[model samples]
Target: MSGFVAGGPPPSGQTSPDGHINTSPFWPSIDLDALRGTLRLDNSISPPRLETAVIAAAISVNRELAAWRIEQQAAGYSKLEEVPGETVKGVPEQVHLYRRAIEAATGAEVCERYRSYDTTNSGGKKADDIAPNIDDYRRDLRWAIRDFLGTTRTTVELI
Candidate 1:
């Protein structure tokens, strides 16, 4: 048989930049392909509405991921602690990392909401004025989510 197929190159013709095979026997499907069609609608409505919905969805997913991570960590710690006399100090570090990751992912959402509220009520407000409250809220939310995820350890460091 020839090296090349009738329609195209062989299954292993070439590798992609990521070092994976370029060809797939089966076609891949995307769940959000419908959203692409929404973009082709007439301009009767503003585009910012769609942008806002996408952002909201992203924020929700971020929160959910953080909650899930906390739950996973808590389960791990519980299993570790169940061993008689075993100590799990790394749980604190893991919790800290989880909080940091959550903040890093959602900081923009918190800042944007603060800025929007401040701009609507007050004439002008710098990010510094609202940062303390934002940090406090983030800490509180992290603790709440962690606790909800089965973490009995209440002491949390907000740094």
Candidate 2:
């Protein structure tokens, strides 16, 4: 037999490029392959785990936007896409920002969970190095959600 495998679907643990992750009825479904490619996630993450992370991210994003969503619905915009936004490339800016929020939240969740995958001394150091990145991911998430909600990122606190 040749080294090349016969044509077929991806292995059990791998994700199909055409797969989509459905979100709440008001939100758009996310493209699984697009997220994996954009995040540079590889097959090391099984499809189930990837799906779990994506779902968690979606839930978090939806919760954060819950009030805004209700307001939009009251205004007669039945879906997220129906809410007006500037077009970026061929997509609406709100959709892009919403996707970005999900991706950032997923990145943070994955990195935090995988930090313990390796327990060697070097792995400990690696985990330390990733700490700042996790914070950055969180920051990105906040910015995306705020942008989607049409709010400023700054926080005012009396000190």
Candidate 3:
């Protein structure tokens, strides 16, 4: 994985000690074999596709947090290095949140199927076709990234 360049926080994301961050991979090089157990996925089936999705999701998650880092920096955070994943709001288990980011990006879903037509009753019951769902990640991703860096959430009293 030579060019497996995880975008180590975008430039706008934040500055680090000496204007450089710990360029080490935020998470270890994901071992698909190991993730199989944690993710409850069996490798005997389509491992390549699953692995690719997970890797892509991880990169996406990193990029998302990079933006949050930038915002945190602008909000007057100096010691940014001390902040990432420090068990703050919106992030309980950092690793678990990363897993969720993967699931969100890939739109991993489980649903029961139903076959029926629209129904309406004059005064008893009513049903209609549903509007399409837009794949918006802004809120959910930010919620996951809230504690990825310095000072994500704060309040000040003005007098």
Q: 24-77, model 3: which lDDT tens digit per residue?
A: 244434444444343343322244455455556666776767765466567765
Candidate 1 lDDT tens digits, 2-57: 11112322134222223221111111111111222322222221234323433453
Give candidate 2 regions above 4 Å deviation. Answer: 1-13, 16-18
Worst 10 residues of 2 by lDDT: 1-10
Model 2 TM-score relative to the real fold: 0.86
Clashing pairs in 3: 13-69, 13-70
What lDDT does candidate 1 reach at residue 120? 40
TM-scores, in order shown?
0.28, 0.86, 0.38
Highest-scoring model, TM-score:
2
lDDT tens digits by residue: candidate 2, 51-113? 888999999999999999899899999888888878989788999999999999988887787
TM-score of 1: 0.28
Please report how far candidate 2 places residue 53 from its true position, in Å. 0.8
Query: How many residue pairs clash in all the candidates, one count each?
Result: 0, 0, 2
Spell out the clash pairs found in candidate 2: none
